[model samples]
Target: MSTPPPRRASAAVASPTAPLIGLGAGAPVLAFDVGGTDIKGALFGEDGHIRCLARIPTPVAGDRTGQAVIAEIVNLAGRFAEVQPSVNPRALGLVVPGHIDTRSGTAVFAENMGWKDVAFRERVSALTGLPVHFGHDVRAAGGAEFRLGAATGLRDVVVVVIGTGIAGALFVDGRPYDGDGLAGEIGHAKVASGPTCACGGTGCLEAVASAAAIARRYSALTGAQVAGAKEVLDRSQAGDPDAKLVWKDAVDALALSFSHVVALLAPEAIVVGGGLAEAGPALLSPLTARLDEYLTFQRRPRILAARLGENAGLLGAAIGARELMVAGGTR
Candidate 1:
């Protein structure tokens, strides 16, 4: 799993203005998660809960592209302020995926969104007149895992996401390690040995094991289009030959990638999330069996489902924003 290391340490004490702290006691942060298809915005209250959450389809093309995303977030900020006009939010917390340089607040690149080197933090901060705390979506999720979720209390764990694409967040010593700005890129790691990837590589894990890859490979083999990885899972359960082969291939490739991670990081647990992880036993039981069959010397880590469901990224974004606000002396 390619996981982003944490950019900072978890808070020593939760503050009144901290993102997930006060819940029913105080105001909430305006949180936004930018994605390829939609932008999800919500008010994450101090009590560690979400309110007024909504989604808007992302606009495509020209200057409206990036600004459109920012605009939705700013509008959400306005709504948050209007609802609790007495105490306004002083900052925004945002989570985005793909090659983000969190330190620079720049999206270095996002192949799915066709974005590059966009100073997203500055844009949002300028538009809202509030400081922005930005985080890589997967990395932020890892932070949440380390501080509060499945990977909590574990010294070393890998959080692997099998979604439209595959990626991961790593936690070591209860903190994320970025390796500069290029640490986690597990999805792009070579795994298939021959298939070409959209990132211009051959045999990338994303090419072989991601949700898109499962559907694409099934289509290529059977000349029939499947809805997504879930449909492929259904067909596999029904004993369809092509579906079985496709699903098996995905598991095998993912196991190969995880093996590499195990060899390198020695994480105590591997937490799996995303659309494919919803498969539960269909993915996990066999994956564990196969990995055990493949390795000899390495200590096998527990392969478990993600506890946070689809909201992990959003929750993580909230945490990242809170940490930033605290660090900046806003709380």
Candidate 2:
């Protein structure tokens, strides 16, 4: 495995004006945010603005070997370059879900994707002819939240994304903590003594509280097939007892999981993002109230909604790519 270059300290913590110093306004960087269902790509211009944004379905259908995923990303990069011929990307950043070892640039494991020990940085760089920085998708989102989004200016924070699954990005002392690719698995934490999870664990927070879980649980109870968690939330608002019960279960599980986070990390804030977060006060208000019930004397962290929405991971990838350029000893 090729080791990544040491990044400059200021590169990670620099203000918004810092990236525009060199090459007239800094060099363009390519960023990709890979999710279970879609891959979002963007090219960050010299002025720190995203351009040529695109999203495509992840290539995981027949590419069990993970080569197709790489090929799809390479193709996306080629198209991005073709679309923006004037801007030659100096570096690339890729963020993917699963147990990612960013220090070694490996996608260690993604259960849903079924890829293990994929050398992401090396392969992507080999195919694209650029320096690459690989990162965990949720952690990258957390980095973006800390640097430019909801958790900015906070020293201790936890950014949790609750979508198909629940994952957390821990920022301790104002830096994202990976814990060697295994730190923030709050989703798998057992929050109840019921319902088995896809991970073969009982009572996992993700199984009970994730967006998919809410919809699944509602359907199991009422035998009503709905689209997703949003439909369940709407049903709850429409006075459906089953939907309300399912939603309450998810909120309770989330509150229970967050209570443990508060007692342990004592963060100043916890920024909640992902699809479930779109419910806004419907989720946050009840979550805060329940979390208060679980904590006795623990420091209460302000629960805030993620401000970046769907673009958080993409922006974080750009940040990582810019740091890679700085780390490669370039201005």
Candidate maximizing lDDT:
2
The regions of model 2 sitting more than 4 angstroms off are 1-25, 63-65, 329-331
Clashing residue pairs in candidate 2, if any? none
* Positional deviation of residue 264's Cα in model 1 after best superposition, in angstroms: 1.0
lDDT of 1 by residue, 1-331 (tens): 3433212212122112323322233335777778777776666666557655666665564433565566667776776666656545556788888887777888887777656788889888888877788888877776776667777689889999888988888888767887765776798988777689988999998998899999999999999988999999999999999999989988998888888889888889999988889999999988998888877899899998887766677777777667666687321
Displacement of the residue 264 alpha carbon in candidate 2, Å: 0.4
- Cα TM-score per model: 0.88, 0.90
Write candidate 2's Cα lDDT for 1-331 as tens digits.
Answer: 3433322111111113323212125679988898888788887788777657777766644325356677777877887777778888899889999887776788888888768888888899899988888888998888888888888799999999999999999999877788888888999989999799999999999999999999999989989899999999999999998899999999999999999999899999999999999999999999999999999989999999998888889888888889877777321
The lDDT for every candidate, in the order shown, is 0.76, 0.84
Candidate whose TM-score is highest: 2
Q: For residue 245, what is the lDDT in candidate 1?
A: 93
Model 2 clashes, total count: 0
